[model samples]
Target: MAPHERACFYVQAQAPQEKLAFYFAVQSGGNFDIDYEVTNPAGGVVLDGQKERQGDFVFAARSAGEHAFCFSNTMSSFAEKMLDFDVTAEHETQADHPSRQNPLPNAAKQREQAAQSLSTIDEMASRIATGLTNFHRSLRHYHTRLHRNMDTVRSTESRVFWFAVMEVAFITGVVGAQIMAIQTLFNTSGKARV
Candidate 1:
């Protein structure tokens, strides 16, 4: 991203009441922060943030249409940013379940019970899946942070080591020059006295 530049992406919701999940992280670059905004189908701001390194958001769609997710690097003057993001729309419609499509007249009661049980199980599974995804993303984010910190530490150590070496060399040169100057002065003074 360039200075004062904004990037926008669109995700379509197939139906009203659909669930939309947005996740983004700044992987590298200046300050590891960026501004983000999410707008609904009617162009109303649903969520907005500034100078955020990572965010995970889930919201229900108010209408069936395209939603906009925009990211801004306007705070960065000369550095470009690297980001990882995901947008997902989850819909729970009757059409998605095969058992709901057709029912037998004879076993209507039993089928209904089974369908309800399946729906419960399906909902639980979805929740678990979402949890795992978030955990994995968090692990990745931490790993990146640790790696960057280690690099900075190593760079500082190298600089300190070199500076110490240079200081020792400078001190040694000054001491040698002082000793030579003292010897020359003593010899000249002794010759004048003799």
Candidate 2:
């Protein structure tokens, strides 16, 4: 960086005594030759390695630090070119597990959960109201359509009844004419026509 110190501290967390990976960086042209040293609070170098240009190194952390990752630019004639770069470390993920803590009492949490459930019920009530209203409207429409069909059926039945009555009257008139004609034929043959 453009800072005067030119070196900053990095905090990497890993599982206890497990293998750890570190990504180290330095400026170009060898002005910044970077190195990393893992240590305990007892001021010991657990692991140390010189950083390569455009490279990375992985090592296990024997103990947690106060790990020193140092970058030196004085090793190059173009120290300005090799100023400062970046380093990163990746840790293996076992799971997204939070440490155990004191849990809240059931009374308070139950009240909060119940309150949330009540809000959900309220939302369902509104939806049910709308649904029932729609159902009622559909029912009314069906009833109206049924009434119209029944009226049409009644009108058809009335027409059929009138046609049947007219047919019965026509048949009765024909029978009466036949009987009268027979009687007249017999009477005229015997005497006069009536």
Candidate 3:
């Protein structure tokens, strides 16, 4: 992101009351902070913040349409920032409904009961998949941070090593010059006495 620049993204909700999960983290640059805003389809602000490092939020849609999520780097004059973010729009499934817990007794439709059980199993599988995806993202983010820190440490170590070498060379040169000057004075004094 550039100074005074804003980036906006849109997420669509197909039905009313859908859940929207928003998450973002500043990976690097400019103090690892940014300004963020989330607006609903009606242009109403759902959430907003300034100079934030990261955020995790979940909200239900008031009406079906597109929602906007924005990030701003206006606070920084020369530093650019990088961000990792995700927006998930999830619809409520029938299998997840509370009323589905107790269905009316009907012996005529044994196949329907079996189908409902399958759907329940499918929902569980989907939930597991989502969890795995989130876990993978976290792992990647941490790996990036670790790699950056390692590079910084290596650079610092190299600079320190070179500085120590230069200091040793400088000291050696100064000592050699002093010894030559003292030797010249002693030779001159001895010659004059002879």
Alpha-carbon RMSD to native, per candidate: 3.7, 36.5, 4.8
Winner on TM-score between 1 and 3 is: 1
lDDT of each structure? 0.87, 0.53, 0.84
lDDT of 2 by residue, 92-145 (tens): 443321221333576666666666676677679879977995695566455544
Deviating ranges (above 4 Å) for candidate 1: 94-124, 143-194
Candidate 1 lDDT, tens digit per residue, 66-134? 999999999888878778788989876644576765789998888899899999998899899889987
TM-score of each: 0.70, 0.37, 0.68
How high is the lDDT of residue 115 in model 1? 90
TM-score rank, highest first?
1, 3, 2
Candidate 2 lDDT score relative to the true structure: 0.53
Worst 10 residues of 2 by lDDT: 94-103
Candidate 3, position 180, lDDT: 100
For model 1, the run of ten residues with the poorest summed lDDT: 92-101
For model 1, give the RMSD to the true fold. Answer: 3.7
Query: Per-residue lDDT of 1-194 in model 3, one digit per residue for the tens?
Result: 88888999999998888999898888777677899999989999999999997777889999999999999998899988878888999877554443345555664366566668878888798899889978977886686577557656777899999999999999999999999988987878656867
List, in order, the clash count of every candidate structure. 0, 1, 0
